[model samples]
Target: MKINVKLFATFRIGRGKIVYLDYYEGMTVKNIIDELGIKKEEIAIIIVGPHDGTPEKMLTFKVEPNMTVHLFPPVAGG
Candidate 1:
């Protein structure tokens, strides 16, 4: 299965480009994060299939084959 990953804000700055990741059918957001080597500090927001997603739960959010995962950095502003 392949998932579309979009990196935003500082996450993009560090990663250089968005990515398409391939994994087994049962893979979750945490699995992708581990495979991509994304640091915990670099991630602020994670949205999967129109709702808030959790990274620590591992399989909490079940991703469909070819689903788009959005990654955003922590907002910093006055």
Candidate 2:
């Protein structure tokens, strides 16, 4: 299955607005993070809803075939 991943702020370094990743059945958010070499501490926010909801762990979190996952890095504004 494939899911849509969105990266924000510093996390968007070499990546564009969104990316599609392939995973096998019964894959969890944790699996995808590991596969992409991303550490939990690096993410500031993790969401399953579109532009809403609380941040959570992707590793233990489960996602469906077409779910949209949003990730952001810690940000500070003056």
Candidate 3:
């Protein structure tokens, strides 16, 4: 299975804005984040398809083929 991943904010430092990952049957969003070397604490928002991904969901949400996952890091400064 292939999953599309989009990185936003500071999450795109070394990695590009969009990436396609080869995922397994039981792969979760957390697995993708770990493969990209991103810390869970650094992610502020996650959008899996049309749903707002919560922290618990990120850990347990199963990634389906062709699903698009967006990851955003926390932003500061007012």
Candidate 4:
């Protein structure tokens, strides 16, 4: 299966803004993060299956093919 990943904020510093990758069935958000060499703490939030509904939890959410997964880094401001 293939999925489209979008990176934002700090997560996009080194990596590009978007990428297309291959994944197997039952692949969780953690699996993608691990594959990208991103530490769990590095990502503040993840949204799967478009921008509707709730964001998927990193550890337990299985990513489906053809879905758009957006990764965001921690937001800090005064």
Who is ahead in TM-score, 1 or 4? 4
- Model 2, residue 66: C-alpha shift (Å): 0.6
Q: Would you give me the overall lDDT of model 2?
A: 0.73
Candidate 4 stretches with Cα past 4 Å from truth are 50-56
lDDT for model 1, on a 0 to 1 scale? 0.73
Pairs in clash, predicted candidate 3: none
Candidate No. with top lDDT? 3
For TM-score, the strongest prediction is 3
The alpha-carbon lDDT assigned to residue 38 of candidate 3 equals 89
The residue pairs found clashing in candidate 1 are none
* TM-score of predicted structure 3: 0.91
- Give the lDDT of residue 38 in candidate 4: 82
lDDT (0 to 1) per candidate? 0.73, 0.73, 0.87, 0.75
Worst 10 residues of 1 by lDDT: 53-62
* Per-residue lDDT over 1-78 for candidate 3, one digit per residue giving the tens place of the 0 to 100 score: 789999997888989999899978999998999999988888888899778765666767888999999998878889
Question: What TM-score, over all chains together, does every model reach?
Answer: 0.77, 0.78, 0.91, 0.82
Query: Candidate 3 regions off by >4 Å?
Result: none
The model with the greater lDDT, 1 or 4, is 4
Tens-digit lDDT track of model 1 for 1-78: 689888877666656568888857778787777776786566777888777744554335768888888877678889
Query: Candidate 4: global Cα-lDDT?
Result: 0.75
lDDT of 3 at 45: 83
